[model samples]
Target: MNLYPINAGNFKLDGGAMFGVVPKSLWSRTNPADSNNMIDIAARCLLVEDGNRLILIDTGMGDKQSDKFFGYYYLWGDDTIDKSLARHGFTKDDITDVFMTHLHFDHCGGSIQWNKNKTILEPAFKNARFWSNKDHWKWATQPNRREKASFLKENILPMEESGQLKFIGLPEIDLLENSELGFDVFYANGHTDKQMIPMIRFKGKTICFMADLLPTAGHLPIPFVMGYDTRPLLTLDEKEKFLNMAADNNYYLFLEHDAHNEIITVQHTEKGVRLKEIYTCNEIFN
Candidate 1:
């Protein structure tokens, strides 16, 4: 199996929101904020090529939103899914599956796009089967007021409307071994209900797609949960369990929202699991 780090785009988010109640003095040290108190973020999607399946794990926020809508996020950089795919000698049409970690706009927005003449919304990858769990599908479709803004209808709905949406059945426990996608998935509820974190075995190492469960290296601290998380206390418990397991097993964390740090490995320290090392996508994936 081959893996590619597909950078959909870069944008800035408020540091306070990203780090929750963590003081700026600490989070800013690792994720330095700009003058506007916004920190850099990457929509770093992952592309998996295994045998007959070319699967894309998460599509960054698509370009379909209006300028006014995007301005709030302070979008930066020229990277697009098309350009990133082309870098690996592929394209949108080449994707056979799009496994969304969750339905948050930043993670799955690129799955759908505006049709020519801007009259209709359509699936961006015509050949890909969009993947989401039944639980998350329901949660996102019927979003609560706390997360309503992040779950945009335009960014979703079209996959089901196009008759290409598929659901992965959840396991009775937190971990599902050897899923149909050809990897183990760790289901997380703190970030969002049934957020699927793919645990992929690549080149003799475990590469975990650390979605919002651990957005950046700065969030390695157990209590450094994102404000966006509905259940912060649940997040703390989930992080403690996951981080300890990650440290003990030496898992390579593939960070999706960390613009600066692509992959990180944590180790047990006096302060708990702290960042042991940082690697760029090239260093690990190549």
Candidate 2:
């Protein structure tokens, strides 16, 4: 199996929001903010090439939102979803599965697009089976007030309407109980309800997609939970357990939102589990 890093592009978000309660004087060193106090973030996605199945995880924010809506998050970079896929000599039609970690706009917004009729929305990958959990599907569709802004309907509804949407597995199971998808699902609730983190078993090693749970290297600390998380305490618990396991087993964390680091390994330190080594995906795999 081969894995490719897909750069959907970059966008700007408030450093304060990204770091939560972490003091600016500290986080600013790594993620320097602009005059407006917004830090540049990468909308990084992952592509899995296994046999005939080319699975794309998390499509970056698509190009369908209105000018006013996009004004808030300043989108930048020339690397688009199509161009990124093409970089690997592939296209949207070659994708057989779109494994969405969650339904947030930055994560799944590119799953759909606007057609010739401005009013009509359609699946971005007409031939791909878009994968999301049943519970997450409901949570995003009938989103709560706090998360409603992030779960845009334009990014979601079209998949089901196009008859290409599929649920991975049962939500209540310890593991993703009914997920027909081949990968093992690590259920994490700290970021959102039943956010499925895919643990891909390849070449006798486990590579975890650290979707929002550990957004960046800076977030490895237990207290560095995102303010956007619905349950911060639950996130603390999940991170502690997951990080301990990752450290013990030497799992490579494939960061989704980290602007610089792509993969990292953690070691149990006196302070806590801290980053031991930072390397790109190919460096470890090759």
Best by lDDT: 1
In Å, residue 246's CA in model 1 sits off its true spot by 0.7
Q: Estimate each model's TM-score.
A: 0.99, 0.95
Model 2 scores what on Cα lDDT?
A: 0.87
lDDT of 2 by residue, 208-232 (tens): 8988999888888898888889888
Model 1 C-alpha lDDT per residue in residues 70-138, reported as the tens digit of each score: 999999999999999999999899999999999999999999998998999999999999999999999
Candidate 1 clash figure, as a count = 0
TM-score, candidate 1, is 0.99
Name the runs in model 2 displaced over 4 angstroms.
171-173, 176-179
Question: Highest TM-score among the candidates is held by which one?
Answer: 1
lDDT of each: 0.94, 0.87
